[model samples]
Target: MRRTVARRLAAVLATTAVVAAGVAMSITNASAATGGVTGYATQNGGTTGGAGGATVRATTGTQINQALCNRASDSTPIIIQVEGTINHGNTTDVSGSSCDVGSTLIDLKGVSNVTIVGVGAGATFDQIGIHIRESSNIILQNLTVKNVKKSGSPLSNGGDAIGMESGVRNVWADHLTLEASGGEAEGYDGLFDMKNDTKYVTLSYSIMRNSERGGLVGSSETDLTNSFITYHHNLYQNLNSRVPLLRGGTAHVYNNHYVGIVESGINSRAGAKAKVDNNYFEDSKDVLGTFYTDERGTWQTSGNILDNVTWSAQGSENYPAGPSMPSTTTVSIPYSYALDNASCVPSIVAKTAGANKGNQVSDGSCNAQSPSQSPSNPTTSPTTGPTDPGTSPTNPPGGTNLSLGAGADGSSKADGTSYGNVIDGNMSTYWSPSGTTGTVSVKWSSAKTIDTVNIREASGTAGNIDNWQLVNHATGAVLASGTGAGVISFTAVSTTKVSFVITSASGTPRVAEFEVYA
Candidate 1:
């Protein structure tokens, strides 16, 4: 059956190329928006086909590389909708090494606004995965990348199924099945990795299985500035380490399922903070919060369920301790998103996580466009956290760091001061507007009482916020107004969200801390 399908696919591809030899080829509407990162990366939140652009159906490695290079040279957004198997037989190792030499790899370097989507059953990149570097605004969906083993090549791209590095930003990967033959001995590295200041990426509804290594963010501990990544509704199975071994970035990991983790999962180190929420881990060991090599890491967990987890020895290699629910660090997604209860994760994940052979995905909650949607017909009731996320169950004295792990957003983002940094418990790090004046906001799933708000300015004199007003999201009322980081006191009100709108500033005001306390 496999051989017959391959023969048919090869003949179709040959005919496609021959038919388009002398004529202008146009893309079909295969690049329709599939939600998640693809929607987020676009201005309309709608991904279109390579409209008004050339479309080429690439089957061999050379044809794929040529098509990509042609689109890249124009520096325009394109969609390279792929079909059939693209393997090492058609690719040459551009790494200039002997290991996996003459093997083909899809290297998207220095390109912008490109979408790679699968057509037909699914597009498979065999023996090599896509490598993205120095690029931005890219989307990859409905593809399978496997068997990427680089033997004898010490100078490879870490042999990852999909690797992004060096100023890469605004990427979305969805519905990908990235796998390997065995471990590093089998010549495969991480399934997905981002390093060297990669930011604003979301990996959703993907499957990574049967591999020794999972993934990593920030190649070194000193790579401090790279951050703002999200991992949601992914299935990680039979992995040993680097369940995204984060170094210095902040990651929002939610609704992911971890099964058969041999050694470790979610290795957070080098001052990285992982906001873990509503995930499921079963038949796995050391599922969360392992600090690897050096430097301590921090994680805040809420509504996570663990079952059949056998923890290993907890000392030496594992630093800063295991994954535990801390009092603070309650996360509120600033964007509209969906969640599936841990009890129903297995059922939903089985149908949605991997490549749907014929584009018939029973994606379950993974496709919910609203933040309030819960799993439909869950097998069991959703588990609740020890405390309500935003509300103080004890109602103790002015609850601690209400904004510590809350979801944050801003009118504009500039430099390395992201919206997440405003409430990240680090005054040294800040969130600045691209322009001199803009709004910065924080959100919560539930309402809470808040009376005090503090602002630490990145610039004390110049670039300080001269005039500002705090607005309530629910009532559309102005709560407080002040200038120049004055400690503002307001009547405590229960609200889901609030924002500080800056009317005037001395210069580009950088907010180091936006602390909300109740």
Candidate 2:
């Protein structure tokens, strides 16, 4: 299936090149100098053009590169208006190294105030969509970066599609689409990987899909606010792994939609404070909040609100909420389980109930919920103490647990292969189908480490299952297992489900009782 898709992409790229060749002939270079500032405008010779009434030849990759990169930084921001297709022809092929003839598409180093607009047709690239390094005040708008990956080289460089690295700031990425055209097994890199002290960055109205990693803000404190970074809108599909990993950064993620991710949807790890709110999710294995802290345990989640969010798993909770202080330095809402539309008022009413509630509530707002006040110390004021600014639950409930359960059958599969199993009053037992040979997943009620899982045989006789394995619900790592009837025992991390994958089963195997003892 992956090979078929790659072949189709190659064919499409070839056709696009043929069409682009005819259009490149009539392109005229319009260079203008105003107030001793010289700037060149390239108009598309093709039928489609840009807003600034400029068109350029699309024959050589250097022409596009020069239009975008070679611009005066001191002047009023070089505007490269791209109207038609910017084809980086099939870097998926083994012969190609970078996207085009150059090592990079747009290498902006120590340059500033550059604007690359796609107009209506939307810019398309085969590899390394836009590379920004040590640049500032750049705007990449109305573009689509598709079919980007390292095909020829064994060692793929960072940002196969689009990359921003090393002291880049004040860049706005809007209405962009980055897709890993390679299918699930291809193992491509992320759509966008911004790292190394990249600050004041905003990615909005963009779609990232079908890559090994979706869109990442890593190794630096970056701001990703008001963007739809997910797979549901057909941005990323047929992926075998997670999407959008936030590693070691302070990112504000809000108002996004995530759907049908195989692994962890959004991971906020390595002392990263992720302010998540007002997002909708569906058909996802894991939705949000995998907060990881280093030795300092400085990462925290605050003002991260999840409202009007829906799920597919039966009786599954939204996000586990509570006073969760993994270590002394960092305090976050580890598990917030709330029903749909329960409102922050109910959660606040539930957590701060009675005498403890009265002390924290002042003038209808939560005084204790402020960042300056620790969960252990409610008396501390919001202004005192060294508090993280982009931290706090934006909505109500002060970080409480609420479970809304699965929405519709079209959104999920009832194959009994979840890491956490939510056994509602309707269903008594869940089973994997006969002749199916893969991991079986069961989710738990809450986050708890697993000690043992009891699986009873339901119908078929148990065969020697040396090739079977059990995986953790949250992390998706294989756990230690010993065989007995259908019983498996392993160490637990959180109140997650235990999944069993049958590798070499002779006959149909059935499981009756699946229990996790904490």
Candidate 3:
């Protein structure tokens, strides 16, 4: 069952709906929150993290674990108020009959009914990761996790600022700041990641910035069990890709502001489905797509403002939803939410999305108020991590230059050029995208067994192709994914056509040869 108060009617619903249900959060000195949990996290039996439980205080990471350890049982409810900075230096493992404590992180392992909220001036987790494994009914709010190193002088959480795996459930994280200075090359992974059957989670009123991979759901194409997550009223800035690379499952993404997205965003691949509604996107490229691979995902877009967003020419592998983006599928949303007018998302989110901003939230009517109002409406989406484009592949398999005399096709051709230039057996001739990047392919009258492709750049434009995917166009299967174009080989498959998709490029790419071999 599915319904849409989004995409199809974003403008109409804004004026029609009254005060939204569950739109509030308050942290007066952060002693504890009096706010209500909204979004999908309220479903699946509800997530009341440490509500009605004994309150405890923790000034360091070890103390936080101690509070968890000292609980009567793993299921005993507890609220731990955190203050000051928590780093690897101040945190140590503590053992208890009811605890699974560890040093590298604030580990919530095999536990349930917990809330860790920041208080006083605020709480910061510096170079430390919050690890949630096999837990249920958890809430994390009013915190900042910054610059966690995966491999350096200090290490924690393998570069993910907050990672949940191993059958976790029912979490609501709000009013937080998760950031890193760089990409994986600088030892930072995802800002938030969920996998291995984690479900029914919500991330609202937060900010994530200055990182490459935003996050991911379901580690691979086969890990499809994770589902029912929401993200709303958040700000994602200066991120490269994976505004969540969701492999499978359903996600609701709305009322967020995204800026400076370099590579891609909201990559819903591997049959995943998302309800992308009422979000503002600016200065980005491929903001919505089923990119890099042929295992396409689906999104239903409504009232989304794509301001100055650049979309590459489409291909079998590089699929973008914008520049005439429409709903590919309808997503069923179980919770009722009040969507603010998309035009006001940027300002509404800026004042209310992160910690220490008085925990203000939307009234679902585009108004911002303190927790003195009711709780906030439920959330929108969880963006995933990206595919690891491997190293330069081996040489093209030994065979005749099958591309010669083949029918040449592409998404678009630049002025004074033709797609047939790529296969004309002349090194001087070339083809380029009508825009900065696009697709070029070779087709046959019938299927051919081929396993290798070599992309040769036209003279003087050698390094423009930064990331690419070789695909079986007939089946939409990614044969190989890698960085830079040379000779890429994969297992042979019989297909009538193959495409070379340039996902990102430093400049206009010129291909003199798109040679294939069998």
Query: Which candidate do you rate higher for lDDT, 2 or 3?
Result: 3
Q: Locate the minimum summed-lDDT window of 10 residues in model 1.
A: 371-380
RMSD of each: 16.5, 27.3, 23.2
A best-first ranking of the candidates according to their TM-score comes to 3, 1, 2
Across 224-281, the per-residue lDDT of candidate 3 in tens digits comes to: 9999999998888778888878989999999888876778889999999999988888
Shift in Å, residue 219, candidate 2? 5.1
Ranking by lDDT: 3, 1, 2
lDDT of each: 0.63, 0.40, 0.77
Greater-TM-score candidate between 2 and 3: 3
For candidate 2, lDDT tens digit of each residue in 290-359? 5232311123333323322333332322231222312223433211111112123222322322211211
Predicted candidate 3: what Cα RMSD to the true structure? Answer: 23.2
* 1 against 2, candidate with superior TM-score: 1
| Comparing 1 and 3 on TM-score, the stronger one | 3
